[model samples]
Target: MTDTGQPSTAIARAQDSTALACQRMGDGYPLVLLAGQANNHHWWDRVRADFHATHSTITFDMRGTGGSGKPQGPYSTKQFADDVVAVLDHLSIERADVYGTSMGGRVAQWVAARHPARVRRLVLGCTSPGGPHAVERDASVRRALAQADPEAARRALTDLMYTPAWLADHPGPYTTLGDPDMPAHARHGHLVASNGHDAWDALQGITAPTLLLHGDQDRLTPPDNLPLLAARIPRTTSHVFPGARHAYFEECRAEASALVSAFLDEGP
Candidate 1:
């Protein structure tokens, strides 16, 4: 562990030759934490320690972000799922519990669907099950995201991700905003992959007991997607953090982490 007690990092190579940066720490049942689009392993920094006593937590940087390779794209969430499997394979971890947020949650759907045996349990937070059936964010939110200036776009997203009161109290170097220096092509790839995700059919194939979590006030992914997921996945439980926004896991870390721990501890 690092001085802050966070895990030590390592690298894993994907089939496509993408170098994935990953971290492993703690002990017991392995647990993988997946970050949203553009964000990296650091996205879970605040809450990772919460799971150390109960799980051997794993985290990694997705392609195009953090220490991972930023290859050209037309990237797909399916490909991202494959990359995740590659990381696990590298570590010789055949199966693990997965917790993902935003785009990472979308990727987790594919992981559980396509490689059912590799996931023992799944947690999806502030995410969507895209395609025609999925409820979308308002047009105004989309418009704000389309801002020409990157800083302005980040600002707009920050507002939507956290409640005003939370921001007032917590000073940031917010890891959730993702890599500012990511190449333009890679950033576009993440957007295309995330926006194009469609998991309605895949959700049914997941063999793991799934947990759907969201913030009631979330505008980015919207709380409506939670029930949609719960209805589709074979075994599911859901919770919506009252008055919270997209980053509810962080905003309500103690409660959220405890809830997650309880669920993962359940017997098959």
Candidate 2:
């Protein structure tokens, strides 16, 4: 899913934080992008322009994703966070403005909670603080995810993940945005890790400034968790995209990037 239009890049081996494969470009302060499960660093495709002009943007393949190596079983959110730290260490970045989408947000939550010193600021988009307090997946979405046919599953899952109008408007990404090479075990590992995440208590202890972004029409990871996140996390603000869905960052790239850029620029 790496964008062909992206800048020249190289992979780094992060030994300290679980040793995943990472790629970075851009200039200025380090702004690391953590993508969701089932995808790799390439998922950041359409939004790179928003940050690259102003910041040293970074993106990586979490273990079990992209060019990274995957070990056997028992992956957890905190482990994912550690992998993030490894990337920063490998790149010689002391701290970074960390942005996490969907399952990556869970990893970011752990970084902010457990390794607060590593994160300068935090952005959690289209994600949840999984626990008893978190919103449950819709039955339709669950069924779609379980579909046996790969293409059917992709279509069905995207149907839940995107707004109807958004899918119609951005057919390119909707149809072509996928990592065909990601292995089945790796995908399952991420899914298992994502489902196991529970940062309910960890949210309150995050030391960095934080932002939560979500689409009002999102069905997969609904807006229902926003209130809970606001109440738990201190020094946090949020933005809602009217009529947007899970992939609002792409569907409304201009507006979303503007908001994110403004926020990133303001932080020290």
Candidate 3:
């Protein structure tokens, strides 16, 4: 551990030769935090302490995001999932719980399904299976995520993330927590990968214990996903945060943290 008690950072080379930026910290059983679409390890900057206090937590920038190498091409959730296993192998973490949000949740699905031995448990928030059963929000809102202007994209996403009442009150830097920098090319890759992701058929293959958290009011990938996920995964638990929106984890910070921390601490 560093002087600040934060995890030491490093880089791990993936199978495709792309360098993945990572942080492996805390103590006890490992827990990896996977950020949503276009977001990076920094997504956990505010909440890292919650998980790290109990588990040997790990967070990393997915390919084409943050400090990770950006190869120009359409990426797939399977490739992203493989990148995660590569990170575990690099850090020598044979088995660990995986928590992923939004698009990261989709990636987590692939991880637990394809490499069942590597993942001990799975936690998914604000995610979807991305096929015929999935529901989509407004097209303009989706378009805003990849808007060329950072400020514009952030503003658009901010409106969609938190509830109107919450936004009216907590007006400050906290708003920027969910918005990470995403270059145009990187945004393209993320959109392509996430848009093409379809884990409807793969959900039943997940053998690990699972938790699905969703916001009842989420416009991006609403509470409907929770039931879909629960019905499919054999061993699944779910919680729906009432009145919370897309960023319910942030909107209901303390509650979300406490619930997640407890789940991670409990043995599989």
lDDT of each: 0.90, 0.81, 0.84
Which portions of model 2 miss their true places by more than 4 Å?
A: 1-19, 174-178
Per-residue error for 115 in candidate 1, Å, reads 0.9
Q: In model 1, which regions exceed 4 Å deviation?
A: 1-4
Cα deviation at 146, candidate 1, in Å, is 1.6
Which prediction has the highest TM-score against the true structure? Answer: 1
lDDT tens per residue, model 1, 49-78:
888877889898899988899999779999
Candidate 1 residue 76 C-alpha distance from true site, Å: 0.7
Q: Model 1 reaches what TM-score against the true structure? A: 0.96
For each candidate, what TM-score against the reference? 0.96, 0.92, 0.92
Q: Cα RMSD (Å) per model? A: 1.5, 2.8, 2.2
Which pairs clash inside model 1?
Answer: none
For residues 64-91, write the lDDT of model 3, one tens digit per residue.
Answer: 8888998896688889999999999999
Model 2: what TM-score? 0.92
Task: Check candidate 2 and list the clashing pairs.
Answer: 17-82, 17-83, 17-86, 27-56
